[model samples]
Target: MKPISFIWILSVWMSLDFIMHGASTDPFDFDQVIHFKIEIPDAGIEILRQSNFQRRWPDSSHRPKVKAEVRINDEPFKDVSVRLKGAAGSFRSIDSKPALTINLDSHIKDQQFEGYDKFYLNNSVQDRSYCNEIICRELFQRAGIPTPRATHATVELNGRDLGLYVMIEGFNKKWLKRHFDQIGGNLYDSGFLKDIHANLTVNVGKNPEDHSAKNNLIAAVYEKDLSKLLPGIMRHLDLDMFLTHVALDTLTWNWDGYAMKPNNYRLYHNLDTGKFQFIPHGMDQMFQNPQGSIYPRFRGVTVLSLMRLPAMQQQYFKRMLHLYGTVFKPKQLVNRVDQLAAVIEPELKKRSLREWDRNQRGIQRLKDSIGARGDFLGWELSAPERALKFPDAGFVSIRNWKTSRLRGDIQFRNANENNKQVLVIESGSGINIGRWYSQQLLTQGTYRFEARVRCENVVAAPNDLYGGVRVRASGSRINAVLTGTRNWTWVAADFLVSQPVEEVELSCEFRGMQGRTWFEEGSLRLVKLR
Candidate 1:
């Protein structure tokens, strides 16, 4: 054979061999294999003031009904069972209730796809239908926490494989009536859940004119005017319940819980007494640790998003921290972590073995599609240390300001280079370095502002060492000047707003002087004065 022909034939043979036997490498597919569609219609439930109902007839009001259409892989399963549950099982069984099933084999064929056989189970055992959800709730309850009962269903498809679905009872009228009768009417409106215009048209609210008519029981309670009711309601709610869930949630960094909309959180209210309760619900454990920061699936937006709105941001952070502290007391938090570790250890062992077998089967089925173990499925346990700490408050940034040139050099700098960064107010002439001072704004009353200011040796003028932070509100500006100081010192001032101001600006203005200056650890707070 000619040399060229021999080489060509050899190359072809090598190509065939490589195609026949090559190392398979690919990433795991995290995409869902089965699709789920949930339909929650309006007009199925009604909410009322817990104090309106008469005593001794708590069960008189009718319970709200729910219906859902579930589809998997474009096929509908008829004869699938559905389950429901609530705070009380004695009045009525919320488990394994029967539901109507519709077969969708014809529908799939109509769509030009392979036909599939599906079954529906409406009446299902609460324990079986929502096994995982029940376990989570049970764990919280065992830890003396408050959580709604988990109701679930299991469906048999083709008499071979099984699928699961869970249904959680809403803290609607029925649940609230029972609890409210026991406790006197005391409730506060939940800021997180409020009434919407659309819910009103659906008759979700008891009264037509009440702005809070469609608000969930939790929100209603939160919005309640009586201050006395809050303490009792908060007392009844198992703080331990919240802590257990939060601890588990922190471990998983459940982002999904944060993503749920207003009505998702379960609430309780009594028509007779007008009392209220709120509880967290509906969680699917999925999280992503980005930049070593655990981002739960439910926390759709970043923490920075809240910081943009200064007033709301301050209130939100303060409220969140207070709640966290209330639920997880220092000693209690440590103990809860130990309990969680105990639970997770055993579960982890079982999961390791099961996951290994599943991975093998999945690899065989997909062939080269199984990627790195940590690539898409590994769970993160701890977040970076910095993420666990509190973030600083300051005028983060400003644009198109009157003193843009003088304030141009002002930038944020890290105090410790390893710790959090602080705003660096650079020294320049004829420019006022302004920061949109973000402290809690008073809706009604007087407030005092104070800060510690220091002058460095690099400052050019000693007599002209005149620079002060200004507090501006509604066309009124109060200036507190710092003078005759070559080192860090404290400066204070007071301001009165005849009317409410949504926000206030804090600025350091340098008049007719140029040199470097350092400002650090600035603070502004609001206090009510008689």
Candidate 2:
């Protein structure tokens, strides 16, 4: 089999020639909407309907592709394979205009669509403004992160006019060549709410069985010692680039990205440097929570572990400041959104007046959020760091927790146990992640959190991601849990506060079905490590 290739140098020359000769032709143009018409046979449409009817997340084995004829801006491409694509938030049935993945060279070898072999047509349900993806991608690219290009499109499938969609460049061999100098590596997709610790499916690779690169990266992230954590991670990751990615994610308020959640991302193990690089995806929801924390609670294992070090924390903050000063321009972004709306809103109005109204309102909201985000980021970056107060004993007893019912029915109250006011959490009939959490402002340092707990009939929730009944601080790598019947034994987890001052959440959570757990009062304490 011949290795897939993209003529990078020739493409560069053509780009220069186009610029020099003032040619009005270029692919991946974001200034205008590209009209796409897809003609699939009845059998192909049925296959798509069946695929969309499943309504499950996109995976390798479940989604099947059917042949179709595609036309882009009046240009034709026959013998293409089209498959329905989306996760939980953006998925729609074929009748309701589903998202699609169009592969140009699947059946026809060496076929290209405007110098691209594959592309995505996103159903812009999550982003009513239809501008977040492009804006966020531009921000990431400006911040020196290798992100895929995105633009607006109006797609018509089988004569049924689907409304405006966000057309994104696909992560194929051409994309790899475009971004990297060397292209021999594995590309792993963060499939459907999965993290790096799970078995991530390889999207592009030479040998799927050889997963040493990914394993090494995970092992580095799992390093327990704070002293060795950054060095270990640096061995397997492009640390600076990764930190820049995190900074951009934070500035954009990408709540669903790799820095916040372990979803909507891609990891590429670069062969030239033997390091992993993160790529952001599913960014339609960026900037939604404009005032969300700059110091976000990281959920990804890699970021959580590296963030435990004070040096890494400082570097992260510095990167955020740099990117904010350089790449994040609120007025420019809002103007871009206006420009996009001007081009897309008319097309949208032609489709549905109701949709156009909704989109206009959404666009206004999006612009306001972008401006608010810029103000918030400026204030956060300019504020002076405050040092937290600690006693001479270097320890504090935790108290005054608020109850949070995450799922199902959970009862929380204070009770007398062994002559002490113990906090109790009782689970109802269904499974729950009942938590009694307290937040405290703390300075940068290492600390150990300990709580004496006793449990009764603590049946662990099936596939519980947080373990069983346990006392832990948010964003900590400590794994300590107590299940079933147990005496008043101390359960402890070590945590490191990396910021100058941060509000850390200490949680006594019971993640189980039908369990009663008691956390002995006056025993919950945080002791500074150094």
Candidate 3:
């Protein structure tokens, strides 16, 4: 489709183009309210409402779409297809008011609102304040990321008001062209992928039939040499933008982002620079869990790898502190929240008013976060902090043997607790994964190793089989193999440490897809047996 095939399809679409663009960067001006009305056919209404009860997380291509007429302000465009969007968010199982992606181009082919063929309306069910999506996006845009512009709307469907909703500018070529100098490139949607996997879905771009750009990225990820890895990726990625993106992600405490998982992000390969940039999405739950360190060191492979370098860590912290001070202003933000609430106040339902009131009381919450994040991060990165000291067999720091090829992601939870050391394992690809060994050294002797492990949703294909923690020493292993699913069970093994190994590897190794396990606590006692 040609860019600018349509512009200002709805009068409301015009105001969303940032009427206050240069005049003033005020976050919200409630004086200008965009009203949206959608009239769906009875059959289409049934399909849309059916999604309210349907429990499934499918790709947008697989989502059920029905024809409807969407009216922005006074104009009505007919025969649009509306369907649920997002992974868990799309599922009505959790939210009866599921998020929607309306596709006007799908039906009319020639019809589009502005240049956007599609648009996103997210249910602000989680955000009682109904301002996080808007707040975070504005922050990202000001920070120079190609992020969506969000504004609240009073949405009515078939004369039934749906209450307060945040309408996000759809991610497409037209939107990209607006934010970027170069717009022609592949846009890969991360659907439900919490990490960069070989099976990631392609939203837009070349099929990679010959595996051109994606292959180079995968090769960089698996490249063992740190020197070569960064340089290799630098060729295909905008590193500065990536760092800024990572800094912003951690600073905003978006645990659901690419840093923490492989989900809620889009990859745009800029053919201009011959590099890819990560565009942020799913900002509804910003600052949901803020107690976490500003540095998400244990998260995404990209962030983790970058943080591993001293210089990159310094650079990340610098950008984080700068953004916290500059882009994020607590008083200004709270004012924006108030402005948004005030403008949309007339459109709010009475029940929503109560929630909005309740949410407004916590305007101080975000303000407090804004005020604290700078100092908090400053103190965190001010000095070289030492890793927490765990008990003798307290905690384990695990890494894959291949490092580059395939490996399991190991993270220790509650390392300070004496009774138990919980480790969460997100199994990586391939079978020959390295052990999750301890950092401390082990003596030459026989030892009894036991751990309490619980497997949840441990999925495996016919050929794939694995899971469980074991004690390894003297080239021998006493381990428990985990598969299918189970509750907390003790997995024990005895092994002789004939040679004094630098580390006692308590290996809970698993390979294949869709597997998650928790290693709660373990004990290593030197056997007195002669």
Candidate 4:
């Protein structure tokens, strides 16, 4: 064979091999930013506008697909379905811009562009930084949780510029493939699973109709055999993964997820392991402020139930500390923000000067968060076991307290013929419950809660209604209940605060009783040992 012929043949073979076996485009490669355009037809835009009214009026609400053209880096693509998306944050039906969902398959046959079948073009109407979802999703992915990737896009409809938008990866079968080897399995979109017991919507799976996995998981959570609950949960669920996911959400303060409410997450019955896994979704809001605690105190029932166990709680705190040290690095995260901003800033400037200025400030604020958030959380993780000591009587005077009833009278009057004053609760049908609250979240400790109380004619409204003081720990409910009637009585309890923010709130209640009650010398003394 001639040398020139041999060289040409070898080059051809190498090019073919590269085309066949080369890696797919990395969806989350943060160095480069993506700019995409959505060109919806005029009729489609009108339908979207009309759909807004129908969305508000459920009677007329119907999801109708409309064809849209897309351009990626000036590369035109045809046939994408654009639809309005969102529940609460679905504002701007006409102008502010409603969140959008684009189905790529709507235009191309069996098309999987950039390894993603569908994409979510969030208007980001609520986010000031316009990168909360992007940064938070990155945080979760870094912490080993399966989450979506985000980038900024330039959106257009009917030749009209719609400004910059955050293009998010949709949570679907493609997401499952990216996260798990077992692609074809039961995938449930636990979308707004307000009640865990209720059935979850099957988003993508072989047995799309099978809800057995979610049902069994819920049953295990409410299992009667408390001793077997942990083992039972471990059987079908990935506890460590779920806990880490929760910790990531907490660390980022993504309240819209399972921590604040059992929503914005997905459950996948992985075929590879035959076990269910929890994945996070919907992260438009995060790092809003540095005020709230990183630990959610297991506010949701899913975590609440498991965290009640000592072993689970220990593992959670351990994982949290580990993640804090290794994954939640402030400098690296801030660098990521700066990198994304660098790519996005130039395009953002093309939109408008005012927008560029506003977005830059927001980006800087996010960068500031990246610098400061780690230390804030580190302080929380390594918080000392300090004594929540109290002052002498009346020294901790009322910061403030409010009653549930719209119309209730609180009067200061002398009681027991003494000069000491007491807060008197008097009403026709409601009872006087002198409720005192602490100003700050209670940390781990033993608290000595005491109050002087007296009630007259405490009605038995229910099976057994009584006037009492209720102490609620952060992770649990109503640890102790104190009651008194017809005469002066000392209501007190020794509260155990095992979790941070354990003494989150205090409540004094007189359930469905029509009577008068007086309270004085309320004290929440921390009990400590020498």
Candidate 5:
């Protein structure tokens, strides 16, 4: 009847950690491997501010100085020494000096993972976590990308063991903050934006008509022209090198890499030398999204999306193919896959068989219970193909709306008779037409609706003809409208049903009679909200 105590839990957890970190027969003992750490002095902050102030676009100021220590059996190795080297710059207000230098023995026993062990040691696969930015940065540099240099070390204390330390070059902050300010602070909403140290004055310009609360702040410090600084930054970047990194990122399922928001990229400018550069930093949560997801699909850059933007996407893709091709053979991707799988599989297998069996069994049981009821009802991937070819057919058919084309033929096929389709007619006299129909109805709930549409030589003003998927409950309705230029685009909207209705309706309304519009494939499926 006694309650569990915190110390008791800690003891049990430590016992498990011991088992996981036990010595292995393999030549390399991953358990004993001590990743590196870095520490930045307060003076280093000023140098980072001045150098990166304007150039570090989309990022915040404050680059912590990094240092790595080597460890064996949880003890620092005293005999080993360490030194840091890279691009030179002022550490305080003085002239530029070596990036960093420190004696490992001077701070051996003091180094530890600090507050991160809970997430890294407890929430990791195989009891391993690349919780260290030093390791991530090293991988980036070795991949031939323009990354800051990183160094490792070993240190020892009087009665303890050896440990590892890592050091990495810091980035400019002034440049990054400027960009964030220019973009209206929307960049902060992204998961990629981190380490927000200070706040800047909010500046809203004269024109309030075209700005939102978000844009005002960023536009205040926005640089109108970036081309002037692109050249110098490109010199160090090697577009090919950066693109190669992106490609490897995709192959590795490095979801974290692609998870960046548009604002995370920084643009550096050396005013004295008239040089400009683009730099990528912050890899703390790198290498996520190894495979695709089924739910609200993981948001990140993908080969598919990249390929869609033929011009810019093609250039980046070719660079990746070319660079990766030079270093690895055609079969190298397969080999790399095997190597990564070998590294991760053993740990995952053990967890699946021992630690996660209960959870896995519960998920499997739930899946079986749902059975055919869980099948997804929505638009097919091939709907685009059918839409492009037919050009005037409803991908999803709703009942009741009349289809009359002053220009093209439109067809509606109904899978169920109870859904309503309404069309709106707009004329110069402010007159509109509305149609109503009814059939069998399903219970009100959240549903996934999708439509593939194309506009052909359509001339319409913003208030003119617009087509969309609509959901209605009682007499109230919510519509997700698709209105833009005469091009194909996908639009989605989430709607909630607060009341019960006997039928569903799909309606298109025309604000004016003079405009023309076309509809292709459309579909909707009712789904239970979790």
Candidate 6:
């Protein structure tokens, strides 16, 4: 063949290969900073201005979108859809640097910018270091949980530089395709603070029909019998993945996430596996409490239910231990934060020297917190497990309960009730979820928890599932509570321990809008069944 012909043929073959394989690289490249310039017309700017001043969050249906022209790394793209996006902490006015979501294919079908159909530019006001989201997501991904990738970006909107922002992969068909075998499944976004049972916004599939998957999972969670419940849950939910997700969330101290708070998550109905998997989101604030508990009081209904099963609890602990040893390496995480800061600091300096300095301090605090958290979790996980020792009567008078404050204003103290020193959990004129709880380890068996409880002016929150005053034991099936003014009453909850060695938390809880609850400390007893 002629040399010229051979050269032309080789060049054409290389071009085809580039077209086919180049898209495989991540658009949200962790090692690089993306440059984005968004141009919006005056009308679009006005819409943002109006929404910014609204007292309430704009309804999604009413949230107006405006046409925009975007340039990614000097490569221009036209006819994109742009809108302001944020929740409570991160939302900003148009005059300030606002978070934004852009859809490249909103107007022009099949159009994608840098292999991304949709993406988010977060202002990172809640995350001073601008690395929390990226780092947390990376940790989750390392633990085999499918999380959206994130990277740093310098964004300019309508000629106004927005400084440094965290660019994140949006949940959509493309993101699904990258993570799962089945991309056609429904992806449910836990909008704002909603959970699985709520009318979640479907991000990528038909909603009314897709809602059935979540319903099925909820149904499975309601099965009280352990034999039936475990199998039922496994049929509709990926328990293995869910356990790992929870472990990572807990170790990272993601108090605002789904497993802990029933918020900031995505539930995807994997068509291929026919099981739902939770995806973590809004993880900008992490390690805020480095010594936070590895086993927090779960608020998500599904997670709480599973936690009641002792066998499942063992699996969860195993998952946490494995992930901590393998994925939650403190030195490695700190190094990652330093590497990210190196890439981000220069760009941040170009934006504002003062902010850049502040970011350096924030990054140091984050690193310190990461190290502290790793030490705490390692110690907590490695400690020898303890089992409650029973006396000749086969009962133990539970004492030395610690206080746990869930939300709003709450107070716990010892007070004289009927000439006895009783533990009191009082709501300080607001909604509250406070508990005096003690954790005890037990072997597989049936047990009875008994307590004397009293309440005055107790008004339960309409949405509080546990309701008013109650005595609950984790790792068992016990749903009983009391409301309204009542004299000291004897209450008992029978629970069954189903593991060789399982730790269970017994709580004297007051969950209400307003109330003063008293528990006879001397009367609290745990009796092993004959």
Cα lDDT of model 1 by residue, 1-530, tens digit:
64568888899888876675443311001111233343323322121111122224433433343433445444443322222222221122221232323233333332211222222233222222122343444444544444544433333322322333343333333333433445323222222223221221211234435534224323423433444333433433332333344444543234344222332243333344243333545443222332222222223121222222344333433333444344323234334333433333343334365633443343232221112212222222111221112225422222222222345344333253224233334454444343433433333235445544554423334454344433333433445554334565555445554322234443434432334444444343333332
lDDT of the candidates, in the order given:
0.35, 0.86, 0.63, 0.66, 0.33, 0.85
- Per-residue lDDT of 376-403 in model 4, one digit per residue for the tens? 8877776534424445541233334444
lDDT of 1 at 138: 45
Of models 3 and 4, which has the larger TM-score? 4
lDDT of 5: 0.33
On lDDT, the stronger of 4 and 5 is 4
Query: In candidate 5, how many Å is residue 429 off?
Result: 18
Runs off by more than 4 Å, candidate 6: 1-25, 52-62, 206-210, 385-530
Give the per-residue lDDT digits (tens) of candidate 2, residues 255-312: 8999898799999988888899999998999898899888888998888888777778
User: Which segments of candidate 3 are over 4 A away from where they belong?
Assistant: 1-32, 49-62, 93-95, 206-211, 349-352, 362-364, 381-530
- Model 3 lDDT per residue over 1-530, tens place: 75653554665565765564634432233334566788767876666654542224333334568877788767678888787665555444212456778777776766865456667888776666677888888888888887877887667777776766788877766677776677656677776654664456666554444347866876776678878877887887799888888878887778788888756898878877888889999887777654677645456777776655555756776787677668866567667777776766666546476756766655556556655654565555433333223355544433332122244443333342346666555555433343444433444345555566676666554564333433443344535576667877776567654322224444544444556666663443223222
Count of residue pairs whose backbone atoms collide, per candidate: 57, 0, 7, 1, 51, 0
User: Which is the better candidate, 4 or 5, if ranked by TM-score?
Assistant: 4
Model 4 gets an lDDT of: 0.66
* Residue 270 local lDDT, model 1: 32
lDDT of candidate 2 vs native? Answer: 0.86
Ranking by TM-score: 2, 6, 4, 3, 1, 5
Q: Candidate 2: where is the Cα deviation over 4 Å? A: 1-24, 53-61, 385-497, 503-530
Q: What are the per-residue Cα lDDT tens digits for candidate 5 across 32-88?
A: 233333333345434443442213343443333333343433544332222322211
**Top of the candidates by lDDT:** 2
* Model 4 residue 97 CA deviation in Å: 2.4
